[model samples]
Target: MMAMTFSPKFRRVSGAASGESTVRRMALVAGGAAILALGAVGGYRLVAQVEGDRGIAPLANSEDIQVNGIKVDVTAKTGAEARLEGWKLAQKEAWKKLGGPDMPVEAIDAMVSSVVIGQEQVGPRRYIATLGVIFNKARAGQYVGAGGATIRSAPMLVLPVLYSGGVQQVFEVRGPWQRAWAEFQASQSPIDYVRPVGAGGESLILTAGQASRRSRLWWRNVLNQFDAASVLIPYARLERQWPGGPIHGTFTARYGPDNTFLGTFEMDAGSEQELAGMLDKAVQRMDGLYRDALAAGELRPDPTLTTSGQVLDRAFAELRTKLMPKGGAPIEALPQEIVLPSSTPSPVSTAPAETVSVQFASPDAAAVDAALAAVRGVPGVRGAATMSLAVGGTSVMRVTVEGGSERLASALRGQGWKVTSGGGALRITR
Candidate 1:
């Protein structure tokens, strides 16, 4: 706003300032457009990389009890007749492997679910094949006796980690180790394996690096997604003599968020053609290691990963303390129905009331309600609420009672609940 004589030098300076300002604005606009274009390209590449053909869908019906390596060779008047005879022979042999008593081929056939042909050659009057027989657990359980009735381990998420070419991966790519685990039939095993198909976000989440993370919070979140109580890591490291020559594999069985090692073994394959079979055998051996660990009480779910009863106990204690009167005295249980004079204040009783955590098996919603109702029906139970609900597994509930946990356990026992008390919590069952 200066009113003065305009000099040429001053005018030229002013023109240069305006030009510089315009150039800066134009540069900013161009830079922003370039950034946007780069961002778009980056986003497209990310999407393509994640959703690309990098996943393998697991085979369906993995719960069936499978018996493999049953070889049959038979000759009949026709190939059809020979094939039928081979299937029947395979079933009979599979029954024997299952510890079943001697029975007619027709009886074994009744229990057979499906026949998987591994390799087959059918001629006009002959059939030779290596076969796998799948038996329906429900139909075969009676004949198999206690093998089908054994206690199964808690749901353990299976992360098949492959270390090949100096790289570790789980669900990052479709590898032989993952395929072997996917093809494994788990119904006959006592380990409840929860195998995730390496698709979508699963590939991103269940990478090899995740196995090394010991953070309980992160593990809890991951396990919750699959409804698993713990994690099982089957580690495989492969070494090849040549591109198409003999290969050796080192397999280790690990469990829990801490990646505790259970057992390890090594296997060899004659060539790439035998790699799948080697992996399959390695998977079976790994499963046996896990089973042994389960028997030794080494495969239990990590307590920190599940709902912490101590947390609920502490929260209940805090609430109780806040509601207490000025004096540090135990709160009394009020009667279900009370009548008092309008002008009289309610009296405070000096009886002790403690919060008890109760854990029980909740196989379904009805079982949850039943357990709650049963616990609430107990004599000293002033209130009961579900702290954690894990249907088809153990669930936890918080019970505020007029007495301590032992008294609550005794009361529950008296009510026909099989009660086990420890660690300030009570486990009850029917």
Candidate 2:
């Protein structure tokens, strides 16, 4: 009958296979296939959520990004809009690389949604905008596993900085990443305080033994809490004595490192070079007031040192000799030292230097006076006089020897008197 057909072949079995059993076997196979298909679909969805097309892909003909399977190139037909689209594509990639944990932007430079001043470069000059990126996403996500199962998407908001003039760099989506900049240069600060609160004024840090009520009051009064605040000092001042005072002591007082005098403190010898340095600074200050005064132009030269009447006549006479113009004034004096001869009383040169007595050899006024006058007679001795005489057997004498020196003893002996000497002093016996 028209090549009567058999649509299927059946295998002979030990017990003839039943139609119902065959149908059942076929149904089982179909069910198994469906399960496999569903499994594949589920796998694909999971991958999409994590990788998003492997994070980066070729825009044009970039080398297949082999790094962590990320795609790194975007080549869109270029125009402002097209380039922007390309940038967006690229940004998607940048975000992907930055995806994992608290991945700090290794470095960031940005361009905002403003008109792209095209592209420029700062650091890796060749490629122009070579961005630095580093992150640890997988670790980060795993760390937050306890919080829940879902991985958060990229940050919701990104404040990209638009740089107009020029500068090229890669930028993260963070607000801090964006900064205004010129091409081939660094960027402007996110927060620039042009004038800080205490920029011009000075501040002193106050350190006291303890922050008692009185100490706090003193600190507040000396330093203005509003104008300039004084921070608390950290360390206590250390004092180390050399067992004996100082080998050669030159002492000064300072408010810590500030040179102004606060009170006297010891400066001693040691390899401790700090002592020498500090001493030099202190002594210099004592002698340097004129310098400070000069800086402020406040030095009024002493009349005796300058062109005061007596001095003026002599200087004027010399200045006139210069064949100088009659109207010209004398040269200014620096006023190196202040001579206060007039402030006190001018001493009479004709009168003798005031005298006193020598107690050692001289027990009477005549003896002490003679000793004093003899020593004063010595050539180099300017003047000499004694002060007091001993009370008990110690007996004291105040003798003024003209030029204070040991030669006075010989002069006294030459004056026909016996002379003796002792610790830190001398004696004359008649």
Candidate 3:
């Protein structure tokens, strides 16, 4: 009230302050609008992905006995009649392949689950096609002994890796190789395959790069997710002669977390139209390679891939450190007599050591380690190592003992473990 009139400096200062406030208000509004726009775009993309087709559906009847490559040519008065005859012929041929006893067409049809047509051409009075016949294992087990009930290996995870167009992928997209494995019938194979139907997060987890990771922790987590004891990588690389032309594939059978190579083979397809068939046959050959490797003991799971293995390794390291000589030389470099402590007496068993196969239930890595530790604690036991590791099932170990398997069994029984003796192997349970 005392100074009603303001100076020109004061008026100018007031105008500058007003201009700064307006700019700040405008900037805040613009920034918020930009943030809202970005969020809207991000939300739209997420919604679209959630509603999209994320994976391929696996075959519903993978457990059936599949006999592929049954070709039939028949002629009749009508197309329907010829088709019917072709199907019946396929069933008979498939049954023969299974080594089943010959029976009437009606009986064979009763065992047939479904007929898969690979290729077909039906005329008014003729039918010619390449077909596959699927036989129900339950219905046909009496005729074939449950598809030859033989010893099957532990559950092996199948990772079908496809390399095409200079890129390697597994379960990233719906590729032909993935489809072939999904359609494969594992009931007849002696190797138990745990196939994943790459959906949602599975596609993200099982990439081609995952095969190269040697970290035991990572592998253990992945195997536990699928209840698999080991991993089987059926790798295929495709080379196209040109666009829409012939394709050549190089296939390899690899197993274990180390990705050890078992065998490799090459196959050719006439064109893209034949790619699927070639892949299907490649899978069959890959299975054969794995089966042979298992028989040769080359496909056993790596003991180091389990957590217990790491614990054992640490223990061994500490023991070696404690045994190291004052001169910093390893205990192995010392004389044999000097290696054993004076307080510990020498083993008295003069019997020659014999290797024995011991089977036990190993529901987890801890159980496997505990079983090995218990068996090793026996006085006559020289060494014990896991030969076949099945985390959620029966695991087998090869043990070398001084007095033979019976002595080892008796010792295990004294330790409160239930032991079963049969087939030259001892099955132990706690």
Q: After superposition on all CA atoms, what RMSD does each candidate show versus the true structure? A: 13.3, 43.3, 10.7
Q: Model 3 reaches what TM-score against the true structure?
A: 0.66
**Cα lDDT of model 2 by residue, 1-430, tens digit:** 0122223443333345575566567667777878888888899975544342111111221111111112223333444444444444444444455442433333111321112222323222122222322223333334222344332211111111212113311121111112111111111111111111111111112212212223433443333222112221111122345543333443322221122232333334453444333333333342243234334433322222211133444455555455343565333322425322223233222333333334455556565545545654554343243445432323444433333435566777778867676664666666
lDDT value, residue 222 of candidate 3:
86
lDDT of 3 by residue, 1-430 (tens): 0123333443343578876666666667777878898899899976664344556666654667789989899999999999999999889999999899979989989988889999999999999999999888789878875533477887788898999999998886788999999888777788988888887778878889999999888997788677677899989999999998999999999988888989999999998988988998999999899989988888877755533343445566667567777788765688987784434333356688898999999999899888987987787665566879999999998887878988998899999999999999999998
Candidates 2 and 3: which is better by lDDT?
A: 3
lDDT of 1 by residue, 405-430 (tens): 87778877888899987887889999
What TM-score quantifies how close candidate 2 is to the native fold?
Answer: 0.17
Task: State the RMSD for candidate 1.
Answer: 13.3
Worst 10 residues of 1 by lDDT: 339-348
Count of steric clashes across candidates, in order: 0, 27, 0
lDDT accuracy of residue 278 in candidate 2:
38
Residue 82, candidate 1: alpha-carbon lDDT = 99
| Per-residue error (Å), model 2, residue 122 | 97
For each candidate, what TM-score against the reference? 0.67, 0.17, 0.66
Q: Candidate 3: list runs displaced more than 4 Å.
A: 1-51, 60-64, 101-107, 136-149, 307-430
Predict model 1's lDDT versus the native: 0.81
lDDT values of the candidates?
Answer: 0.81, 0.34, 0.83
Candidate 1 C-alpha error for residue 381, in Å:
16
